[model samples]
Target: MGSSEFQSPRVIKAAGLPYFTPANNGGAALNPEDPSTPTLFRPLTIRDVTLKNRIMVAPMCTYSTNPDPSSPAIGALNDFHIAHLGHLASKGVGLVIIEATAVQPNGRISPNDSGLWQEGTDSEQFKGLQRVVNFIHSQGAKAGIQLGHAGRKASAVAPWLSWEGKKGSIRADESVGGWPSNVVGPAGGEEQKWAPGNVKYWAPRELSTSEVEEIVQAFARSAKLAVQAGVDVIEIHGAHGYLVHQFLSPVTNHRTDKYGGSFKNRIRIVQEITATIRAVIPDGTPLFLRISATEWLEGNPVAEKTGSWTMDSSTELAKLLPEFGVDFLDVSSGGNHRDQKVEPHGNYQIDLAGQLRKVIQQAGQKTLVGAVGLITEAEAAGQIVQGADEAVATEELLAGQEPKADAVLLARQFLREPEWVLTAARKLNVPISLPVQFARGLL
Candidate 1:
C-alpha cells in the first residue's frame, strides 16, 4: 500500500483512460499516484457517515434462528451468524447489510427468520443485533440491517430444509417444526402457491386498514431500535415481492382503500414508513430503500396481462423518496409475481438503476443510486463504482444513459467468497487494507 505501487505512468495512463477522479475527493491528478484512492477504493459519504469504500455486502437471508412463541422469533445471533458475517466484514468490505429481518412476528418469511419486533433495550433480539453491529465496526466495515415483512410469502421452511426434501412438503407444520400460526398480505384473494421441489406455499390472510397501520408503526419502531443498536445504515426491504412491494404493485394490491389504488395511494404506506423512521433516527444514519424497480410482468407479452409495477413507476417513486428522507435507492427487480419474466444475465438490473439515477439527477435531488446483479468481475465492479465501462460495444450501447451506479452491492459473490473484495483489489491492481492476521496468507 505505497504510492510507488501506482506511480508508474503506464498504470496511471491505463487507469485514467476509463475513470476520472471526482471533484469532491480531489481534482483529477495522476502525477503522484495514490494507491489507496482507486475509483473502487474511494470512500463514499452518505448523510453524516462515510464508508471506507463502495463495496457493500448485500443482505442475503440465512434461515437460521430459534423463534419465540409469543413474539417474532428471537433471532439471537449465535456463533454461526457471528462467524458468517464477522468473517466477511474482516475481509475489507466497506459495508455489510444484514439479512431481511422482520419488523413484526407475522412478517417473517420463515419461522426462523431474524426479527427486531420485540420491545425493551435489553431484549435478546436487541442485544444480539448490537453484538453484530459492534463486531462489524471492529472489523473496519459499517453495519446495516434490512427491515422487511414477508407478507403473503411467510411460514415456509428454509431453502436448505426444502432442498433436502426432508418431509416432501413445503408447509412447516407444528408437529415437524415451529411454524408460525398465520401469514397475512395486502388483499384477500386465492392464495398464490408455489413449491419448488418439495416446498409448500401457504396463502395469507388479507390485512385490514388498521392492521396495515399497525405494521407501518412496527417498521418505524424497528428503525428506532436499529439506530439504538448502532447500525450505520437502515435499508427498507421493499423489494422481492415482500409486504411493501405487495402494496406497491397493482397486480397484487386489489384494495380500494387509501393504501391502494392510484400511484400515490399505493406508495402511501412506504412513504409514511420512511417519513416516520426519518423523524426518529439521527440525521447521520443513511436510509436506503430496496425496490424491485419492476414487476417484470407489465411489458412482457407472454407474461400475465396485469397492470403491474413498472420501471416508470419505480422512477416516479424514486423521485419522491428523497423528499421522504431516503438517501439511497438500491435498485433490483422481478420478485413480485411467479409469472414475471427476467433475463438472467450479468448486470441485468443495472439498466433499471441507471434509469432511476437519471431521473433523480434530473429532478435535482442528491439521492444516490446503487445497483446489484451479476456484477462478479473485478473490471465490472470497478466500472460500476467509477461510472465508466471499458468494453467498447457495451459502452457505446450505454452512451446516453446516466453514469453507472454510485455503489454496487454484491450478494452471491460475497457468499461464495467472503474475501472477494480483496481478490478484486488485487485483480484491479489497487492496494487495499488486509487484516494483519491474514497478511501471511495473502503473501
Candidate 2:
C-alpha cells in the first residue's frame, strides 16, 4: 500500500476528432487517411457534430434508476449510469446513447424506467443527465439520448422481475408504483391488448386527438431539456412498438380521427414530433429517428385483412424525413405486433437500412442511415460501413452499391465487451489509441 507501489497518474486528454462542431481539444485519430483502415473507424460529421468513428453504442436500458415511492430522484440517472456509460466512452466508442428515456411519467415502460418529465435545469432529472453528459464529453465521445413513450406498453414489469414470477403489464393498480388503468394506446379495448391471449396486460384507453398533440409537445419539451443537458444528438424513439410505433402501424392504430386511418394520418404524429424537436433544439444539433422498417407480417391472415406496416411504407417515410429536419435514420424492426413473424440472422436489419439508404441517395438527401440488430461481429460491421457486398441485380438500384448504412449501432454486444472498439481495431489489424494508464497493456 506504499506510494512506491503505485504508478504515477497521467492526465488523459479527450480522444476525439478535430472537426467536431464547437470544436474542443479532444484527441484526433492517429491515421484518418489510411486507405487500409476500416470504414467503421472513419469519422463522420453530421451537421455540427463529428463522430470520431462509426461504432456507436446503441441505447440499451439498464433499469437501474430509483423508482421508489419515497424517492424524489425517481427516473434520474445515478452513479451506475455514469460508470456504465463513462467506461464505454473511455474505451473509445464513438457515441453512447442513453437508454429509451420516457418524456413523461406515464410514458415509461416500467416504474423503474428513466424519465425526463420534470422541468427546469435545476431539477434532479436535468442535473443527473448533465452529469452523465459531462463525463461522456470528458471521455471524448458524443452523448445521445432516446426520448420515447411506451404507450400501452407502459406500466410493465422490468424483465428481470421474472425472478419474482411476474410477467407482462402490471394490473395491480399502483402496487409497484405503476398506473395500470391509465395506460393508453392508439386504440383502446381489451381485444387490442399487446399480447392477444395474455391476461397480464390491462385494456388500454384510446387517446383523444387533443391528447395526442400533448404527447407531441412532451417530446419537444424533453428534447429541449436534452439539448440543455448538452446532448450532441437526439433520437426520437419511433420504433419498437412504442407510442409512436403504435400510431405508425395500422394493426395497432384504429383511430377514426386525424391521427389515424390513411398513411399520412398515421404518420402525422411522428412528423409533428420531428419538426417540433428540430424547432426547439439548436439547428446545429443533429436529430435522429429510429423506426421499425416493417412489422414483419408477410403472410399473416390478419395482416392481409388489416394491411400492415411494410418496407414500402418505411421507404416513403424515409424519403420525407430529411425534409422534416431529421439528420439520421436508425433502422430497426418487429415490435409492433404479436403476429410479426421474423427469424433473425446476422445483420438481419441491415437490408432494410439498405433500402432506405438507396432512396435517400437517389433523392440526393444528405440524411445518414444507421443499421442495428444482430450486428455483433467486427468484420461484418466493417463490411456494412464499407459497402463491401456485391451490387444489387435490380436495374433501378444500379447507381453503384451504396454502403449498407452510414453507421452501425450495437446494443447487447457493447455490454458484453465494454472495450469493443479497441477489440474491433485489434481484430481488423488497425492501430488505435488507448488511454495512457492502460497503454502498457497494448500488445
**lDDT by residue for model 1 over 1-443, one digit each (tens)?**
97566554222321211232111211111221353345566677899888877789899999887755654336665556778987888788888899999998778777778889888789888888887777777666889999999887777767777778666436665654444346778886454443333346676677899999999999989999988988999999999998999999887787898998898999998999998899889988999999999888866653354488888889889888878899989999988787787877876798788878878878988889898999888888877756322222234235753356888899999888878888887887765655645767975
Q: Which predicted model would earn the best lDDT?
A: 2
Clash pairs, candidate 1, are 67-73, 170-199, 170-200
Clashes of each: 3, 0
Please, what is the TM-score per model? 0.86, 0.90
- Looking at candidate 2, the ten consecutive residues that score lowest on lDDT are 19-28
**Which residue runs does candidate 1 get wrong by more than 4 Å?**
1-36, 68-73, 166-169, 176-181, 191-199, 299-305, 387-402
lDDT, candidate 1, at 395: 40
- lDDT tens string, model 2, 333-362? 999877789999885799989888888888
Q: Which sections of candidate 2 miss by over 4 Å?
A: 1-28, 163-172, 197-199, 387-401
- The local distance difference test score of model 2 is 0.83
Q: After superposition, how far is residue 316 of candidate 2 from its true place, in Å?
A: 0.5
